[model samples]
Target: MVSYITSTQTLSFARKPHPKEEVCGDDGAAWDDPDHTWLVISDGLGHGAGAAKATEAALSWITANYSNNLEATVRGCDKAIRHTRGVSLNIARINRSTKATDYVSVGANLGWKVQRSGIQRFAGDSGVVGSGVRNLKTTRVDLDGAGYLVLASDGLNTTSDVSALYHSTFDGDVSLAEACLERWTTGKDDSSIFVYRFT
Candidate 1:
């Protein structure tokens, strides 16, 4: 697990490998610039080292050539890891001042925004990152007030009610992530969860 704190937001990430595997297939990263904070999650196709390799390649490309443009960044990641097993990818760019976020996702990854009122789900375009992308589009949402942004790989049960989990066990960013992983992980594949809290 890793955590990042800023003046406006706090982010926490946690991941676990499949029970039979030594390496996790899902990976993620978060970084900040003067004007924006970036978050990314990548889940490779299968389990074990090959899947880990694909995720590592995608994250490395993003680290070396970080960009604020969500679509272009996803395309670049697709190109960078074309040789390895393809991955499911999601990227988010949040404005430091306005709290508006631009998010893009490809493949089966999941995302949601949880506020006091309700939970808003974010869906990704249908395609694999390294293989190809179709109907690529960026979704925008406002994170100005208190809320939580949750991103998870398919290893976590998508059918689970995250809003209920948030409301019941909401302590802080780190605890929310830990609870989600503890309660929802499928245990058959690599699992990852990212929770971002903004006020």
Candidate 2:
């Protein structure tokens, strides 16, 4: 588990590997620039060393070359891990000043926005990174002050209601992520959850 706190937001990430595997195949990261905060989640094709390598490559590339252009960032990640096993990837950029969020996703990743009104789901385009992507597009939404943003790998069930979970397990971001992992993980794959709270 890892956590990041800023004046405008708080981010927490939690991950677990398959019971039989020594390394986790899912990877996540959150970072802040002067004007924006970037959040990413990557799940490799399968569990083990090969899977870990693929996600690591994707994260490394994003860390080094990320820009405001989300589509270009996804394309760059695809090319960066072309030699390794493919991965499902999601990237979200939040404008610090405006609280507007831009999101891009591919393959089986999941995203949701939890607000006082309701939970809004963001579905990914169908394609594995490092293979090929089709009909790629970015989703933009206003976080609108105080709310929660959740991103998870397919290893966790996406069908559950995230806002209810937030209300039921209303701890800090770290506890929320752990609760999601414990309650929804498939137990057959590497699972990961990222929770971001912005005010």
Candidate 3:
């Protein structure tokens, strides 16, 4: 089996139910299949209960149908959450055999491949998954050795400033993702980051 590891960091708006809020603004899921490893991050449309509901709805759909191809999984999520507030989501699948990657995004979430060479951004199309999806497009890239794909919800500050990550030694450590998530977090809204390493 191919070696794959994931690290995640999540924070709630104002620290959540400490103030009696029912849910955070975002949620996510991850798993490994025979041919690919999957990582998904979802941000609901707004803050508080509605946002949490939307994200959870989308996440449930993702969990139930992620075994499908990237495009179909996204469409399933879109259909599943149409009655809710909708969500912004990013899904990434790493091919266990070829070390290649297939990913799809909807709404404002950000994702990218971090390699020794440089960062390869996965720009998502406009429109929410459960709302006004005009089209769904999958971005494919080869995730060669020592490559990492990072997916972040919009709650983070700047998705482009991933330079610090490349500076770290490529020892296949989860600390890199932890450090990046800690350093980049704005602490404004519900924030989360998922790191997938192909080793």
Model 3 TM-score, 2 decimals? 0.81
Which has the better TM-score: candidate 2, or candidate 3?
Answer: 2
**TM-scores for the candidates:** 0.91, 0.92, 0.81
lDDT of 3 by residue, 1-199 (tens): 0112333232111112112345676766776677766778888887788888888888777776666577778877788899999999888877778977888898888887777778888878888889867778988888776766788887777644775666745334545555665666666676667766565
**Candidate 2 overall lDDT versus native:** 0.84
Model 1 TM-score on a 0 to 1 scale: 0.91
For model 2, residues 8-63, the per-residue Cα lDDT tens digits are 43676789998899999998978888888888999999999999999988888888
User: Which portions of model 2 show Cα errors greater than 4 Å?
Assistant: 1-9, 170-174
Residue pairs in steric clash, candidate 2? Answer: none
- Candidate 1 yields a Cα-based lDDT of 0.83
Q: Candidate 1 — worst ten consecutive residues by lDDT sum?
A: 1-10
Candidate 1 deviant stretches above 4 angstroms: 1-9, 170-174
Q: Whole-model Cα lDDT per candidate? A: 0.83, 0.84, 0.71
User: What are the RMSDs of all candidates, in order?
Assistant: 2.3, 2.2, 5.4
Residue range with the least summed lDDT across 10 consecutive positions in model 2 = 1-10
